[model samples]
Target: MKTTSYISRQVENLKPSGIRRFFDLAAQMDDVISLGVGEPDFVTPWNFIEQSFHALEQGYTSYTENAGMIELREEISNYLSGSFQLDYDPNEQLVVTVGASQAIDLALRTVVEPGDEVIVVEPSFVAYVPIVSLAGGTPVTIQTKAEDDFKLKPEQVKEAITPKTKAIMLCNPNNPTGTFLNKEELQQLAKVIEKNDLLVLSDEIYAELTYDDNYTSFPSIEKMKERTILISGFSKAFAMTGWRLGYAAGPADIIAAMVKIHQYTMMCAPTMAQHAALEAMKNGRQSVQEMTESYKQRRNFIVSSLNEIGLSCPNPGGAFYAFPSIKETGLSSAEFAEQLLQEEQVAVVPGEVFGSGGEGYVRCSYATSIKQLDEAMERMKRFVEKRL
Candidate 1:
């Protein structure tokens, strides 16, 4: 039998992750300065790591409850309430998953019926489109622009709505763009959602990474609590990317439905990781703040440097990426990325891979050390000068 014949049509239809492709190419080249990775370069905080070690030393290697350890859920609950004034009952409104990625997938798989239409704001996370497709839902993409700081506008959401629209997936402090949706902006979106009776999947994994202001949680919007599923995790903020832990909070019914899928598929999040997360939730605030400060400094430098090099980047309000326009370079986003990699040995993801509005730009992650960023910026500057 042909290999293609054996593959599920859903799986076959999906394109390989564009970000992963760049990483693979970068791995083969010597001395490549990569700005393509998304995770923090920092190690997991020492206290969190110590807690993980203590858990292992005590032989706490058993499975957690299907919904996760109650203590951990309580910590999550407290973190949400304390940090964002968002309240969720730890008992019935939360489900721990392998990571925020799994939380997003489970939420999509649980609520999306075949042919359901999901409004995806772009340039959004790479996973949203494929996840919606895998859930047998059709994705309707609404492209946000650089002029508006890439925020999803109420008018755009209103225009995208159809009778089939089931949910809206939002990535605040959005991946690639690093743009956040403020309170007033979310309120405008809330009105449209209320009128249409739609659900919301909010991916706020970068909630703690925002600079200049605190993050506004989707569920914090008046009357949006029951309709929103807030997805967050340890990966981005705590620098625990490899630990693979996350959770979802929302109405009990929807969370229970997601937990049903989780019970059968994942059983539960890793027990030791949950223990570490417990520690993180309890005392990791200072570590998170220090890291966010470092990222803010890097963000300022990168945005300044990119602009100086003739790439017009709108300063991102949150998260650690710089999305700089490459339009003036007279190259398509892909051509700019490819040639930059080949000539300058610097790897950055082409914004075109992010979705429609992402064309004419590139997403460079500032998650690495400043020294590496400095080297990459210098290399990029030389590359831009040559093209000029």
Candidate 2:
């Protein structure tokens, strides 16, 4: 018998999430203003919680269908069509998953055979590359530069394409950076996608949190729906991070493949969450708008404060993050994040953990309260003034 370690090489080599590390560190300390975790500060709305409680009282605790309840699927179908002009058959084209993260995993596993090259744009979420690797695919990166506003250009996609290229993974109103590609930009990228015959995994979890009308759903483009797997969830816009609910809509055949894997691995999303999500889809627009407006206010304040504090930050169009360059502090992203946490008791994530093009910057999520943000900014200013 061959002697080898019990743990698979793939699992063993995976890096711990940098975001989680800082979040945990902050959790252990007192009086730490946390801008490290990318979660909403608002609690899940009471109405949604009430719906879940009602479901439980009605004894609806059993597992749902592997693809989720038919009613929830229909609501999801209607949402995409009405919001993004993307149509998908509820029965054959959509499958609710544990979260958008799980949907991303299932989508990659369904289509990416071993040796397939998945083009990943960075600085992106830390999970994208690792998930691609776990699905037995290679992650080819396209580095979006800060000077260019971190937009993914068509020529960059064209240059990254290879014969083995399977798909491109994108996070619209992207995490860590909060940079979103507008309609014109998507049109240009669509040209390259059509030319290369590639697929797209569009993660639009923050779709409803746009600061303006600049956000464009990827699959809404001409003929792009057929080649795209649209992943979204209630975590961001609806303040349902703990609910563990998300869904994917794509081509029927592709969805079926994903459902097959999901059935064996996850079976179905939480029945209670599915019920709450149904309520959210039916009557949660007002709440969403209110939360979005608050985030916009925080975004403005944070960007203005970061600039005054000697950190150069871009105005993020959407999502609740402020990606500020800490280069002026004469320290790397990790160094800045560490010293800030130690000295000022402000927790922000080091940009390097998000992959290439992330160095020299830190991702500070403005998803917390205005008062916390104000104090964190003051502490950051004190820290940076000493070095500058």
Candidate number achieving the greatest lDDT relative to the actual structure: 1
In candidate 2, which residue ranges exceed 4 Å CA deviation? Answer: 1-4
TM-score of each: 0.98, 0.98
| Span of ten consecutive residues with least summed lDDT in model 2 | 1-10
List model 1 lDDT by residue over 36-64, tens digit each: 88899999999999999999999999998
Cα RMSD, each candidate: 0.9, 1.7
Residue 290, model 1, lDDT: 97
